[model samples]
Target: MNKNRVRLRCTYHGCELKQTGGIPYLAPYFDPLLQLLNIEVLDSSNHWKLFSKHALVHYGKQFARLGKLKRNDVIELTAQLRKDGSFVYPAHVRLLTNGPRREKIPESRTELIGYVMTQNGLYHLGGKYEYPHYVNQYENWLNKKDSTADQSKAESSSITPNQSYCHHHYGTHGNEKKGEK
Candidate 1:
């Protein structure tokens, strides 16, 4: 065990984790650990912030031990839910070539990686918004277009056509006689 390697214990009660490698399996409800460790919640909107920060430090030390992961080296992340709703043994560990990091980690060591742990009360290993269904839903919303009235209203509000132009083009109120001088 390297001096800098920080061992991550199970946040769940009564679970003794002797080995420390891979990502730290965190529970959806991590406030208890934060309270126990007195880790301040920097942003209430991002729940996983604190845990992610700790994971990087823990993993960094592990990386140093394994001789710094090459650019394309595989890094796997596995997490399981214990009986008490916290992460259990995180046993299904595997390795794959470089994975995606849509939201890149910042240079600052204190930054937290925000992610949703559970959806509708089930423990899912994939981080929040990783499913195709959710991605499709977001795509639908992105592709949706405003109604005609909404478009007209926005156009009218932004650019008021000159009265003279309107009269010359369509005439006022459609009441102009065809031959009126």
Candidate 2:
């Protein structure tokens, strides 16, 4: 297998399109137009009969990535295998234009679902949310979560033990030190 070479196959479920002997071509890369043709091969419906650029969608049980692929980038398409012997090729590029901005959600919410690239946009079957890019979403979610935790720590550290005690025991109007008579 060529290191730079990649296979382009549409393993979508219930898709009528199939290649003879299931032979897949190992291409160096798949451009926008070729990706569109791949979608046509996978889906038999008219949903993608007319479209502009298609996005290579990576579908995973807990994550996904979707976006415009570069001409030289080594691409790998993957999806969860089904028991019915039909491949769940969620990684196929679909007839999707600039759909929605890809954003990351909590990790707990990402489980048990697969990413889907459709004519409408990218969707998570497990959740109601839509994700355009999977890799970026995971990274952004981690960064956002980390920043939030750091902010919480900073807020907590700003208050000293003495300050807390004084604020809780004494009102703003009675902050003066008590002197024994």
Q: TM-scores across all candidates? A: 0.18, 0.24
lDDT of candidate 2 over 18-79, digit per residue (tens): 12232244211111112222222212341422121243332332222434232333333434
Model 1: weakest 10-residue lDDT segment is 29-38
Q: Could you give candidate 1's per-residue lDDT for residues 69-179 as a string of tens digits?
A: 333343332343233323323333233444453222122111111111121222334564333333344344334423544776776675345444466456553345566
- The TM-score of candidate 1 is 0.18
Model 2, residue 170: C-alpha shift (Å): 11
For model 1, the stretches where C-alpha displacement exceeds 4 angstroms are 1-127, 146-150, 158-181
Q: What lDDT does each candidate get? A: 0.29, 0.34
In model 2, which runs have C-alpha deviations exceeding 4 angstroms?
Answer: 1-132, 165-181
Best by TM-score: 2
Among all windows of ten consecutive residues in candidate 2, which has the lowest summed lDDT?
27-36
Pairs clashing within candidate 1 = none
